[model samples]
Target: MFKFLHISLLLFGAVFATCARAESVLFLNPGSTQEAFWVSYSQFMQAAARDLGIDLRILYAQRQPEVTLAQARLALQGGDRPDYLVFVNEQYVAPQILRMASDSGVKLFIVNSALTPNQQALVADRADRVGSLVPNDEEGGYLMMKELIRLHPPVAPGKSIDLLAFSGLKITPAAQLREKGMQRALAEHPQVRLRQLVYGGWTQQRAYEQAKQLLVRYPDVSLVWAANDEMAFGAMRAVSEVGKEPGKDVLFSAVNTSPEALQAMVDGRLSALLGGHFTLGGWALVELHDHARGVDLNQYGGRDRQIPLLQLIDREYARRMLAMGATPDYGVHFRKLSAKGRPVSYRYPFNLQTLMR
Candidate 1:
C-alpha cells in the first residue's frame, strides 16, 4: 500500500487518515478449526500486518456461509469494528455478508470464493468488496495433467488406460475447476482413461478411505490425479501399503504445493505438484492491505479474473530445491512488485530459486 513507512509521521497521518486509530481486519475462513492452508494464511497475514503496522483479527467457520455472516455482524457490534472484512468465499452467503458489511461500513475482500453475477447485483455495487484471491487451483490442475502426459504417453493404439481421480470438496468451485482442467488433458490424450472420481473433501483420512475403495474397485488404474496435495499424499500411502512404488509404479499428480507434498515429490514417493497456496495467501493479504488503504483493486494493474502464476514443479525440480534447502517465498518467481492482472509465466528473468542443500 506504500502508506506510512515513517513511524514518526505515522501517528499524525493515522489520526487524520481515519486509519490512525489502529486499523482492524477480520479474516473469516470456512473451517472453524485451523487447517494447513489457513494456518499458512494466518501466519502470512500476521507477518504482513506486523510489517505494515496494522491489526488483523482471525475467525473460523464450519464451511457454512451462515457462520461467516453471523461473524460479520458480530464484528461490527464488537470493539473490533474492523476496517476490512475478508472471507474464504462470498458465493453461498454473499447477500447476507454484503448486507452486514454495508450496515457496518466495512471493506470486503473475497479470498477463496466470490459472488456470482446475480449475487453481485444484490450487493448494490456497494459490496465494500475490493477483489478476490484464490490459489491457481484449476491452473495447478492443468499443469499436473501436462506433467502426467509428459511422463506417460499413449503406447498402444486405443490403449484403455485407467486412472483414479480424487476431487476436493464436491461442491466448491475449486473442485469443479480442477476437474475440468484434468478433463482437458484427458481429452487430448485418449489413452489416459478416467475410471473413477471420488470426492475426498480435502482430508487425508477421507482421501485414504477413498483410495482404498478405488484400489479395490479399479485395481489396474494406471495413474492418479488428486485435486489436492494432501489427497495425493493419502493415495501415496495407500499405494505404498499395497506393495507398490508410488512414482515408479503409478504416477501421481496433485495441486497445492504443500511443503510436505513437495518433500514427498523430492523423495520420489510422489510425482509432481502444480501451483501452491502458501505464497498466494501472503500475496492476497498484501492485496487486501492495499485495498483497505483506499486502493481500488481495479487500479494498479488489477489481477481481476486473470490467472495467477501457475507453477508446475516436477519431482526433479522439487528435489533440486529441497536438496539446496531453499524455502520458497511469496515473490519466488514473481517479477516486479505488481503486474497487470494477467496470466504470466515465470520463465523469464526470475527463474525458480534453487536451494543450496
Candidate 2:
C-alpha cells in the first residue's frame, strides 16, 4: 500500500477498533439507478463500499434539481450525521447543497459534475470539502469529433459533411461543457457543417424520438454525435430505421463506454466512445474514506480533478474493457485490498492513468 493510504487505513483501524461504529456515506445521484449511466456508477460504489466496510445510502433525484434538494434535506435531518456527502450537482443545486453541508460541518465530495466558479470560490477555503471528481468531458467531446473527422475525410472541392448533435439537458453543466468542446472541434473543421442540435435529457428513448425528428427535418445529415452512449445507441436505431447504415452512410460517436456501447463499437455500430467515468462515484468514496480516516486531501491538493478517459477508438481497446466487465475494482489500487496493499498514486491529477483491464 502507498504510505498515505496505509496511514489512512491505520487510522481507520485504530479509530474503529476502539469505537466499532461503521462510517456512513450519503450519495446524491442526479439520475435514476435504472439508467445505464447511474447503474454503472452505483454498482462500482456498492462494490467499493462493501470492501471498505462503510454504510452507503444512495438517493436518486430522478434528474430533477428540486428532488435532489429535498432528498439532501431529508438525509441531513435524519438521526445519523453522514460522515461524508458525496453528490452530483444538477439544476444548479450545488450552492444550496454545499451550504447545507457546510452549515452541518459534514465533509463534502462532488462527483460526475463540477462546481460553478462562484461555488468553487465559496468552498476554496472550506476545510470540510474534498473537491469534485469529473471526467474530461470537453476533451472526450473533442476526441470523438476529431476521430470522426479522421475516419471520414472531407470531400474535395469544398464539399462539407453535415453533422447533427443529440445533447443532454441544456441546463446541466456536463452537457454544456461537452457541447462547447463539440463546437470547438467544429470551429477548427470548416469542412463539417452542424445542421442542428437537440436535447435528449440523457435518455435513449428521448434521444430516439428527437433524432427521428431531426433526421426527418434534415435527411442529409451525415454524422450524429451524442453526449452519452445511451443516446448514441438511440441515435443508431433511428438512423438504421430510416434506411441508413450507422457506420457507413451515417456515423455515430459518444462518451461513457457502457458494456453494450463498447460491444457496439467493436461490432462497428458506434464510431467512438470515451469512457471510464463510471468510477467517479466509487473514487469519490475512496477519497472520502481517506478524508474521514484523518488524511487531509485538502492539504494534499485542490478540487475539480479530472480522471483520464478510456478512449475505445477501435475494437482492441473495446475488447480489453469488455474483459474488465461490470464490477470495476479500481478502488483496490487506491485502498489496501489485503494485508499488503499494492503501490498506489495519491496525487490526484486530471489524467491519472489509462483505465484498461
Candidate 3:
C-alpha cells in the first residue's frame, strides 16, 4: 500500500503487520449521479484512498443538506465501527456535526474549503477532529483570472467582466471565496461589463436551463463565469445546442480543473479553469489514517491539523496541463483515459481583452 511517509513516526514501510485489513474510511458525498461533479471528485478520491489502503465505504445524499446531515448523524451513531467522519459539501452543518461526533469518539476531516471562524474555534476547541484540507481558493481564482486578463484583452473601453454564473451550493465556502478572488481580479479591469450573474445551482440540467434563459435574455452577452466545471459543462452544452461556440464566441471561466473543463480549456472550449485542492481528500484520508493508527500529533505537541494546497489552470498554461494531464494530485492522468477523456490543448489561448467587445 502507498502510505504517506510520517515525518516523525519511525516506522518506514508497512505500518501494520501484513495481516490486518486496512482501517476503513467512511465518505459522505453530497449525491451520486455519475455526471455529478462531486461524484467525479469522490471517484478520484476513491482511487487515491484505495492506493493508501483505506477500506472506504461511501454513502450518498439526495442533494439535500438535510439528507446529508441525516446520513452523517446515522453514520456517527451507527453500529458499524466508526473511526473518522469526513465530508465536503455541507459547511453549515459542520459545527453541529462536529459536536455530535464528540460523544461518539469520531474524528472529523474537512476538505475543499475553510471553516468559518466560529467553526474553526469550535472544532479546535472541542477537539472535534483535525483542522482541514482545502484549496487556496482566493489564490487559485486570482491566478486563473490573472491568466485570463493576460491572454484575453477586452475590446471595449474598460476591460470589465460579465457573468453567466452557476454554483453548487450557496453555503459551500468555495463558491463564495472563489467569487471574492474573481471580483478582485475584475477590479483590475475597470470597463469589464458584468451583465448576467445568474446562479445555476450547480446541477448540469439546472445550469443549462439557467444559461439558456440568460442566453435568450441577453443574446449578445458572451463572457461566462461559472462556479464549477459541471455548470460550465452544462452551459457548454446549452451553447453548443444553440450553435454557439463555447470558448471562441463566448468566454468561459470556472474553478476546478475538472476533466471535461480541462479538456475544454485545452480544446479552446473553455477560456480558463482554476485548479482546486481536490487531491487533498486522499491526502487527508492518509492523515486520518495516521490519527486512527494512534500517531497522535497533539500528543507530539503538534498544534495545527489543517493543511491547504492549491493548483490553478488557465489558457496561457492550460496547454501544459492538457499535455501533462490535469490531475496529478488526485492521481488522475487524463491521457490514460480514452480519446474522449484525453485532454486537448489549445494552440491559441483565449484573450480576454480581445474577446470582450
Ranking by lDDT: 2, 1, 3
For candidate 1, give the lDDT of residue 210.
83
| Cα-based lDDT for every prediction | 0.67, 0.76, 0.63
184-240 per-residue lDDT for model 3 (tens digits):
877887655566666666667888888778887777656677777778888888888
The TM-score measured for candidate 1 stands at: 0.80
Give TM per candidate: 0.80, 0.87, 0.75
Top of the candidates by TM-score: 2
Consecutive 10-residue window with the lowest summed lDDT within model 2: 337-346
Predicted candidate 1 versus true structure: per-residue lDDT over 64-90, tens digit per residue: 667777887798666668787777653
Q: Against the true structure, what is every candidate's RMSD?
A: 6.1, 6.2, 10.5
